[model samples]
Target: MRKSLAVLVSGYALAGLAHAMAPAAPEPDAPRTAPQAYAGLGVGLVDYSGGGSKASPKLFGGYEFTNKLALEAGGIDFKKGYGLYIAVKPTVPLTEKLSVYGKVGVAKSRREILPIAALPAAPLVRKNDTGAYGAFGLQYSITPNTVVTAEYERFGKKKESGAKEDVWTLALKFFF
Candidate 1:
């Protein structure tokens, strides 16, 4: 019984010494949720329901009001067309370095149907249109100020062909 008691006391003392010698934990830096402005560029493929696809590039910028919300505006290049959009962006954090975000709002597009070589006359094309826009994406934070993302965006119906425009892209975003 005396031996067991001595051993128990020694263990407790050793544990206490180890705890006292351990380094203190540092406080974490400020949260990324603070309001910030950001910009991004993406390259992707655009597919149209009417029957064509092309490589597309997009440019965008926005202000994040919080970790969960932001406002963004951007432009995209499509096959024989182009689009500009403004959206409300909402985010869901999945982990310390990963998140899913969505964009919903309005879009303006201009498109044309090129005339065939054998065609006698060129078809008139619409210069501008206003419509709905949407998108969803996943982003992995590479640093507090940078993230890499993959997204799919849809610029709603085309009035000229009654088709939809969809884009899939990989992007890099920077926060300031």
Candidate 2:
């Protein structure tokens, strides 16, 4: 009786270990979620404060590790100039389909200046500058993988001319 009881207890212990090592099953009724990575393209108007306003185009990509945070990088062509930027975005959800976010980053920009023919010595100017950038935006999810956003962004002033740039953009993003 004692030997039989020991064998039974050992069998139960091995069975418990097997059960603990088994992989968990996924829930079939879980809600759909967004992908971890995405890409976006946008076009809008850039207002160079006290300078002028012109059409601008931008391309960007990002990765979301969690629902509330992401890292992004992009390039923008603003009128006669262009810039490359990288930013961190922190987001807050207001509803199931709407959210707000803020971005802070750094940018490297190249500005082209036309020659001043009226001046005594007419010379073309090209300047490369680097500065901080910030933005705030609202996003609405049209589908699990698509989002639309409207945002306002500000680029820091140029080192030489102290001129700042701002843009208002509408963007569409897709996650894969």
Candidate 3:
């Protein structure tokens, strides 16, 4: 599931890139949308390849360079630790009020497992790693400055030792 999600996101991003870079006939007087900043809070379930699933919260902020392009940075709670990421978001509008987007970037994460109460003799376990991150999501506009989003994000899918993670969320995003 993780591998296939990666492939799908990678393929979509590549295709978007190819289309963006290709020359095209200029449209007549397309209105330029100004760059905007946005922030969001998400609540959802987080699943780990090692640890069990748990409810989690995520916080994110970004600057959209255009209606179709943005740079975003966000953090997610992992109970034992946390994950942070920065990604380039490319979006495709499906309608006047809906869009699909993909995020591709780097994530730095760390997880620490404390000795269990039943195993006081055991040592604490710590894992730190930096890896690729990807996400795919949909957005539906509620007002000019507000939208609701549903997303699935993955972190450190090919890690050598640390836990791999997934987050599924429904969130509210506000633009300023």
Candidate 4:
């Protein structure tokens, strides 16, 4: 019984010593460092929209409002009568240089389609358009504000045509 009592007291003393040597815990209300903001410009080609395959150029700009939130804007074929869009994205970082994001946006597009002609008739083209779309994409940031992207976007059907515009694109982004 005496030997067991001595061992119990020694164990308690060792535990006390270990506790005294441990580091202090952080305060619960301390402010942590904020994540960096990132912005960029991008360009790419879009296909599977406007009634057929078309080569479209795009430009993009974005600001990271927080680590997981961003606002963006840009146009496709800005120099011509092309599609225009603006979007907001929620991004989640999966690694130091990789993240995935989804986008929602408004788009304006103007497209021309060739009209079907009968024999001995002249071929003509007509214009079709949409003023808005829902956009979505996945982004892989090679650097802090630059990314390689694959995107799919959908716009409401055009007037007088039971057709919707949806395109898949591959793009490169550059940070500013």
lDDT (CA) per prediction:
0.82, 0.78, 0.83, 0.61
Q: Estimate each model's TM-score.
A: 0.74, 0.73, 0.74, 0.58
Give model 2's clash tally: 0
Can you write out model 1's per-residue Cα lDDT over 9-118, one digit (the tens) per residue? 99999999999999974334334866999999988777654567667788999999997899999988775678899999999999888999999999998876555658
**After superposition on all CA atoms, what RMSD does each candidate show versus the true structure?**
11.8, 10.2, 18.5, 14.8
Local error of candidate 3 at residue 174 (angstroms):
0.6
In candidate 1, the residue pairs with backbone N, CA or C atoms under 3 Å apart (3 or more residues apart, or in different chains) clash, namely none
lDDT of predicted model 3: 0.83
> If both were scored by lDDT, which would come out higher, candidate 3 or candidate 4?
3
Query: Where does candidate 1 stray beyond 4 Å?
Result: 1-31, 48-52, 116-120, 158-164
Model 1 scores what on Cα lDDT? Answer: 0.82
Off by over 4 Å in 4: 1-52, 78-81, 119-132, 158-164
Over 4 Å off in model 2, which ranges?
1-35, 48-51, 158-164
| Alpha-carbon deviation at 130 in model 1, angstroms | 1.1
The residue-level lDDT of candidate 2 at 33 comes to 47
Count of clashes in candidate 4: 0
Candidate 2's TM-score reads: 0.73
Cα displacement (angstroms), candidate 3, residue 130, comes to 0.3
Top of the candidates by lDDT: 3
Q: Rank by lDDT, descending?
A: 3, 1, 2, 4
Query: lDDT at 71 for candidate 1?
Result: 99
